[model samples]
Target: MRVKITKTNLWEVALALKILHFADLHLDTSFARIGFSSTVARFYREQLREALKRILKLAQDEKVDLITCGGDLYEHERYTSDTGKFLQGQFENIERIPVLLVPGNHDPYLPDSLYRRLFWPSNVKIVTNAELMPVWNLGEVTIWAFAHLSPTQREAPLNEFKLSDDEGNIHLLLMHASDMSSVPPGKPVHCPFKPEEIHRAGFQFALLGHYHQGRLSSLQASSVNVQESISAPGYGYPGTPEPLGFDESGHHGVIVLEIGDGKVKAELRPISQFAFVETELDISTATSRDDIKSQLQYWADEARGNYAFARAVLKGQLQPEIELDLTVLREAIGSYFRYFDLQNRTYPAYDFSELAEEKTVRGAFVREMLNRIKLATGEEKETLRSALTLGLQAFEKREILEQV
Candidate 1:
């Protein structure tokens, strides 16, 4: 059952309730493959442990009554007893704060899941029930939650369940769901639902997980549902406190919220230790790899992170005759970060107009390749063009063939 709050008593309930919301801890995730080094994996593990220590300290310092983890506390396939014990030990630090959590698709509630097999501290409460259930009633707040038992969960969380009455309690939901409206690229859609469903559910607040980027906002109940209910105060995805890759940019951290009587307040707290950055530079002006190295070095020095693991990409059309010594560029800039991936995605900057005017084999080659490019489709056309331009450039270097 869920309880809804009225506007008259919103502030009182908001003041009494204090929450430390974090999600997608993903402890023991395989960073080894991403970094291609054992030491990097160990480094990432230590970072996760440090983040836990910081969050616990924050909870105690701020006197938060509830510590809510939205989901994905660990990586299911790679989780181990030692790491699980380490997590349990982290929870033991919070003496009185009630830590509530739901398992996400990554760490689903399987039969042999860590949620079931391992023992947690008394203060910890993991919602691993297969069904959507109301597990706790704290004063004026009621929490409805459930765990993802498998990697692919298709149920629409709010649509499948029926709610009780307002009953003067603030209804808060904790679960992992993909916002069908703005699902992040490459993110799996588990427990998918439209935003309108959340608003019509009549919950005072909904704290969600799964997407690595945090987005918090208040949404009013839409008029689309004919059988409508009262509007919700807000919903949010706290995101992964730590970033998993270079693609996840911007500040990363947990959210702190206070709910009482009928009011709710939420704030994001940053806890990023290292910066995962990706910078794309136009290499059309550059003639060699040193230019690329300089551009990447400049970006690294400018980033605000304490430690930077950056991916430098060379973009834009390049001169056909320009040779890029990527190995040299990587070696020069690789020392600036813990990990680095240098990639070149440039096409030859050929002057087709100039080549067309030349009364030579190069001009003839260009015309032939252009003809094929019109008839050829996709990668084959691009490959033929590259081959023709680079080959002509090679022949031009022979000196005797430049005019012909």
Candidate 2:
């Protein structure tokens, strides 16, 4: 029972080796017990359950023979029997196809890990150690995997794997790692690895997990630390299958790779039970509280859904008399979606004529600050003025600067 998918000079098809690539599911079974009230925990539980169902349905629709789950299938180190039962039930639904897993940092391959105790489907293959473990060999293709289950947070043994065989069979390496220093600074370094080293390791394609934002890149490491031939052309991270937080947005999906004839074609397929969106609304002309609310409501209604999570930021000048009721707006927005944040940055319309005319020491200080503001960039001027205003208010109220 197999579908033939072949590329011909004139659109003819014969056979295609299709596999779905996805990672960082973060299916938190403990989410129900992690601080959220019983009701809220129930909500999280349902959401997680729905995501699993969605993935299985996706596999069925796509009719893939193999599903490559790079890693982080679960949230953490601990899982109750109930959670295990739920996972086993959901996985049973997906047992029709093979699922290849690479263990992530959170759910490492410790003796007590679920990967050790759980009786997954016979089609499931969990790579437990940092060694080349071959799972699938389809004539011209060979998939090799290495799982990083190191107990410590810092060391990554998988980074030592750098083997390249350009003329050999199609080699696929499955791993979960990061390039900490190479990425933008201030971000945490997790499962660090050198991109060029991976290319040197002689793999035709490296299926990676971790960093739940799906993206594809050539073998070239985007850094100066590692220098190697960049001709090897296979690298990517299939971000989380679903959005776990606000930062993960746009194109929440999975990658489908077709490997045959010593070549690979990748496509991204998006899936999510609930969508998350962030929007900015200019409030420069918003004259009153009612106006602001109306504008927000209009924008909210125009968004993807009434139940979608959103963050609306109001920027520009605002009248002093009007006070925006963020609480009321959030409630008004309804329960389908939660408004994570609403920030009002409308500056007050002001006349500095009186302050310029004053002769007191405080007035002189204000005058000096104003002179400096003239020479600053728009951003700098605004920041300085806001600071000065806050300081003045604190002085008048006889409050500490920190309190202000």
Candidate 3:
């Protein structure tokens, strides 16, 4: 797939140019706002939409030459006309900047896809075909992209590409694909490619989509011929532009790539309106609800990197006499953040070494439990340990009912 250009380099920047690349938005008006009342749902929907607006405006603010969306632009199954209009309207407002897009598994280009129905803005360019297509050439930059026509794609588009650096133009591949070597178990294996196949194909930057976590193939940046000072062999996933759930965490943002002047550099610009943060809080030393409240408040406030969706893990060994009323604690602190979940993983601080030496029934029970635990693996170990703790606590008149 080759695209021939007639226009002189569209961007007149001196060797350095910025391309804002992002993917896996999975925009759904129904999702991220489920189970709320109509009015409340609209409020939550607006929050997500507002984040998209900020991302679209970023291209103009950064003065980027091209805005590439790797894929999953919308939730295909749940897409509404309002969302289609909102997305296309935003593209219209992008002014004269170029917007390139491909469809991901969640938003594949089926016969009835929004890509086929809607009239996109003049600046928008999307590869709706299932094959490898290099349809755009802006003088110095060329883009080869394809869409996921179906959920199960066995074709390897990367294999069809053959690199020709003899022409000396910046070549980019925009598609939603899986790096088959390390794709996690059970993840939809769509448009898979082996790293060696990608390296052999020879595209400088492959802006891939689908996976929600950002990563670069090790081979993407390491292939160097001493003859060329700077190389474009590096490819990276920009991850989900805005984190959707607790599983999607850390710096949620877009990547700004500078691909000229004998070196290739990329910077992550975090522009999401919400960040998902899972905090592991050590509550072993927590003596009371007030203590837990103080720590929760501190982290809950900090988690609003914009607005936080937080899961606080209460862990470590708890003091024998102290009891944490989790329902009360959640009611008191849940309102501190946009989305909150509290997990009780704290264990009782038992003097096991001292108890192991005693000849009493409790000591015998502890020893028997310890012996069984040593032979167990996985969740079985944890279950047996909890059973022993609960059995002893019941014998000692320490049932957890009164605290709730």
Candidate 4:
């Protein structure tokens, strides 16, 4: 993921340097996009292309000497050859400045892989080994990086790295790793390390990649080491150079870092031309189709973001005669936003009084159900109501329980 930067403050007296820090650019193949339905697939491609173009232009405008990418450059190992060729062309645009990358879990280095086999530009350096590889140096500043290409995903206690003198030199540590707690529940468990340990490794700044959402500041635990002077700069996750899915929304871009004479400044640049907006709407007052339509219209109008792909959670009580048409609502939102998910959470308007007085089979069933609900404990009643609600949904094609 390469973090993008448009501008930064310049140091007046000292020799200062600017670097564009980005990471977790999982460039998936067009084939994978096709699996997401045709419209969705095309949307993904557009975001990816726009993000790449933005970062390349940002680098040139910032006059960055080095573009440091944390890791996860590709989505997976199965991208088409044309994808590699396209990346090669993009790399050529910034061939004047060195682009340093460390492989992340998603785009791990494999034997005979396209990343390893392809002929990259001379300015690009792929750090595949685990040892500290000193690559970039200009005017006494050194970029010490460790590429985690080991079979296992996690690296910690960055013991191999010993910062050079703090005088006149900016020591930056670069790698791809996720904080232990941030790993998604079911995803493949990649390398996880404590941020505190990495910070205390004596480096002035520890620029990281892997976790998608951008993170800027953190503190090192006292247990790691006491020798380092400054707390590490936990830069930002470049996110995906593009948005992969609905969850992958909000400020999708890179970070630009300015390090000069022991002082560092970090800024976030948003490249996602499209916005993924997820909002909740209470349909408690909506009685007819037109009422719901007006509410939807207001929501679409209220969508205030760069690009909108919103999902409105429609909740509350629904009228007995009213039935929602999901297809119509999905269409009504239109291409103003790429996608809008109208989730129905409303309960049916059931008249309990009418059923209580009857003696028929259906009436008896309703009476007994009500009696049990009134007599049972709160926990027991809630559990039973859940079962009945699901059963009713199966029978009526909509919710029946009243949510309070």
Q: Which candidate leads the pack in lDDT?
A: 1
Candidate ranking under lDDT, highest first, comes to 1, 3, 4, 2
Candidate 2: 10-residue stretch with minimal lDDT? 1-10
Model 2 regions lying over 4 Å from their true place: 1-16, 29-45, 77-79, 132-138, 150-160, 164-167, 179-187, 219-232, 304-307, 335-340, 344-404
Report lDDT per candidate: 0.75, 0.64, 0.72, 0.65
lDDT per residue for candidate 2 within 1-404, as digits (tens), equals 11122322211222367777778777664543223345644565567667767777788888987887777777655556666678788778877888888887777887777788888878788886565556676555667776757534455534555433223556577767675534633445556777666556656667777776666666644544221112235566666666655567655557777765446666667666565677777776877767877887787767736446566677776554455566766566545354244655655454455666679766776787788888899889888877666555554564322210
TM-score, predicted candidate 4 vs. hidden true structure:
0.76
Over 1-404, each residue of candidate 3 has an lDDT whose tens digit, in order, gives 44343433323323566788888777774643323345644655676677678887887898888898888888888889988899888989986888888888888888888988899998998778777767677646667788888767768776666755344566677788987766755578888886666556655667778777665544544442111122446667767766766677555567777766534566666767666678888977787768888888888777754376567888888776666767777777778767666777877788877887889988888899889999999999988877876766776887563221
Question: TM-score of each candidate?
Answer: 0.82, 0.72, 0.73, 0.76
| 2 against 4, candidate with superior lDDT | 4
Choose the strongest candidate by TM-score: 1
Please give the lDDT score at residue 97 for candidate 4. Answer: 81
3 or 4: which has the higher TM-score?
Answer: 4
What pairs collide in candidate 3?
204-232, 220-234
RMSD of each: 5.8, 8.1, 5.8, 7.5
lDDT for model 1: 0.75
Candidate 3's C-alpha runs over 4 A off are 1-18, 29-45, 164-169, 180-188, 194-196, 215-232, 257-266, 285-306, 348-404
Distance (Å) between predicted and true CA of 41, model 3?
Answer: 7.9
